[model samples]
Target: MVNITINGKIVQAEEGEMLLSVIRRLKIDVPALCHHEAVEPLGACRLCMVEITKEDWNGWSKFVTSCLYPVEPDLIVLTHSDQVNEIRRTIMDLYLARHPNSPEIQKLAEEYGVLKTSYEVQVDGDNCILCGICTRICDAMGFHAISLVGRGHGKTVAPPLDEPPPDCTGCLSCALNCPTNFIEFSDQGNKRTIWKKDFEMLACVKCGATTITREFAEFLSRNRDIPFEYFETCDACHRKETSLSMGRIAAWTKEAQS
Candidate 1:
């Protein structure tokens, strides 16, 4: 256990844990977004910036992303210093200028006491707030069906050229992974047939058996597109994999054969 001092108080942490994890473990005050232990830590938001001062270190330091920053023995960290707070507030303001209707960003701004920004609030047709959390999650989870496109102020998260992304398994992983709730699956989408709601990713199981409200086989057949060969398995498939590797696939097979 390393005795890391946060604002002069010694706190202990195990190896490989981040400073944000350490602070949370110590019940210290820190701010964060897009920081979930269950998912990979991407330092995109820069909202969890902290001021870290070590024993051997000189001068105050600003850290943009605490989720990825590590804490070591004898480490000294200051979570909320004047400089870090100002930068965070500025970032928040810029985000607000772009997305005034975003509840998530507004709540964070309120926490930091950011009243408002001088820049005009622009509204895009899409529900995305451009946090990059959704796209990042898809990539981290090995579902590279979507991406952020364009550049500078014109960036948008979507499939390339607004075409139906081939990698999409109708899993609703994009909708599930999104932060702003931008995508709403429905029976209607003009880009392609697979964009329809009935073709969305259906959950079954990890095993190659079972039926549910949405099945990959059904989706794949309807879309006339099956980019990946091994899109089998349902949520409950993992638990029953050891036994009966094959089951009353007879019913489905007959149905399939017909």
Candidate 2:
């Protein structure tokens, strides 16, 4: 166990666990962007910066990304110091400058007391902050479909050349995990469109609900080398169907009587 002092309170934490875990476990209010429990932390937003003072260090405390920093014994951490707050404000302001109209970024700016930034706003680009959560989640899901395109300020989230690759299964994981709502998907007829790729959806036989993408279903089956015939059924319809089929002899007798 690692013993650390967070905001002057002593806490015991596991070694190598992220400092954000300790801070969150202590119930300290810290804003997080580009962070989700299911996905790996990228620390791209820099919103979780906190002041840290090592036990043996003589220099001034330094700011670090709490989500990426590992917990260490005898470490002293401050989550909401003036320096930490200023860094958070600056980060939020920069994000706001890039995405002034985004409600999510606007809310964070308002919460962090940053009404606006002196930097010029680029209007022609999308509101994505380049946090890479979408790309990371897609990679984690084993589909290297979407990615951060271009370089520096010119970068944006999309599949290569704004066109989805053949490997894309339209799983929608990227759109689902995006923090800035920069990704969009649509379903029309039997086609689901995302990342400039269209996928055929498997409709549930009983309820006609679109269950999953045909490409994604095929990927899962082929990757796992398993046959799962029920993938075409949505959960609700599947449950209803399984319940009806539970007792075939009784169902036959009931149907005959009816």
Candidate 3:
């Protein structure tokens, strides 16, 4: 365990743990858009930047992204210092300029007191903040189906050759995990569409409701050692069955005791 001072409060944190995790553990309201526990921290979004210094630094403090900075003994962290707030506001201003249409960005910027961007706004811009969360989640799901393609302004998340990803199982991990909700997918009855690809969804045998794509079920069965029949029922129906079985077990136990 390492002891560190956060906002003038001494707190103990695990050595080598990221500062953002510790800050979150303390229930500090730090805004971080590109952070997800499922993947490694990329520090793509600079919103979680905090001022850090040590007593031996001669009163000099440096700004660092909390998501990437690890906890060290006697480390001092200022999560909401004046300089840190200004830096976050500047970054939010740029985000508003780039993603003017994104409600998420707008709301966050407003909270940071960045009502209007000083830079020119991209009115036709998509909601994608390019935080890379979607792509990272896709890779974490073992599907490497999409990635940031091109460079600079031309960069975007897309499949190979801008075509439907052949490896995508329509599992919706990328879409669901996206911080900005940029990825779009539609479900209609037993059909699912995403990234211009169509997939056949599995219907629950008990409730006749759509559950997951057949491809995802098959993949989980093959790789995770789960039986494919497990996906035959929806989650709600599975819970119901579990409750009934537990009730029967309790009754059997009571009768045996008597």
Candidate 4:
């Protein structure tokens, strides 16, 4: 454990843990767009920048991204100092210029008092901020389907060869984890389509309701060692079965006691 001071409050945090995690645990509002607990921290979004210093550093301090900076003993962190807020405001201003159409970006920028960007707005720009959260989450799921292609302003997340990803099972991990909601997919009846690839949706045998994609269920069953038949039922039916089984057990116990 390491003792750290945040906003004049001394707190104990696990050594080597990221400062952003500690700040969040303390209920401090630090806006971070590219961070997800399911994957390793990528300091792509500079919104979580904070000022830090140590008593032995001769009063000199430096700004660091909290999501990637690990906590150290006697570390002094200022999450919303004047310099930190200025940095965040600048980043938000740029974001507003680049993603003017994105509601998420607009709301966050408004919080930082960036109602209008000083830079020229890209009116035709897509909402993608290029934070790489979607690509990172897709990679963490063990499917190298989508990736950031090109360089500089031309960079974008796309399937391999600019075609439908063969390895994608319509898992929706990339689309769901995207902070900007840039990825789009559609579901119609028993058909699910994402990345221009169509997948057959799995239907519950007991309730006839749609569940996940069949390919995802099979992948889970094969890799996670779960029974394939378990995916045949939807979550509601499974809960119903579990309740019935528990009720029967209780009745059996009562009868035996009598």
Best by lDDT: 3
**lDDT ranking, best first:** 3, 4, 2, 1
Deviation from truth (RMSD, Å), model 3: 1.6
- Candidate 4, 200: how far from true, in Å? 1.3
User: Which 10 consecutive residues of model 4 have the lowest summed lDDT?
Assistant: 135-144
What CA RMSD would candidate 4 show? Answer: 1.3
In candidate 2, list every pair of residues with a backbone clash. Answer: none
Question: Which residue runs of candidate 2 sit more than 4 Å off their true CA positions?
Answer: 245-258
**Per-residue C-alpha lDDT of model 4 across residues 1-258, encoded as one tens digit per residue:** 879999999999999999999999999999999999999998999999999999999989999999999999999999999999999999999998899998988899889898999999887899888889888888888887889999998988899888999889898988888888899999899999999999999999988888899999998999899999999999999999999999999999999999
Residue 116 in model 4: lDDT: 95
Candidate 1, residues 155-182: lDDT per residue as tens digits? 8887756777766656555565665556
**Which regions of candidate 1 are displaced past 4 Å?**
27-29, 123-129, 186-258
* 137-247: candidate 3 lDDT, tens digit per residue: 899989999999999998899999989999999999888888788999998999999999999999999888887899999999999999988999999999999999999
Instruction: List, in order, the clash count of every candidate structure.
Output: 10, 0, 0, 0
**Model 2's TM-score against the true structure:** 0.89
Residue pairs with colliding backbones in model 4 are none
Query: What 10-residue stretch in candidate 1 is worst by lDDT?
Result: 188-197
Name the TM-score of candidate 3. Answer: 0.94
TM-score of each: 0.68, 0.89, 0.94, 0.96
Provide the lDDT at 251 for model 2: 84
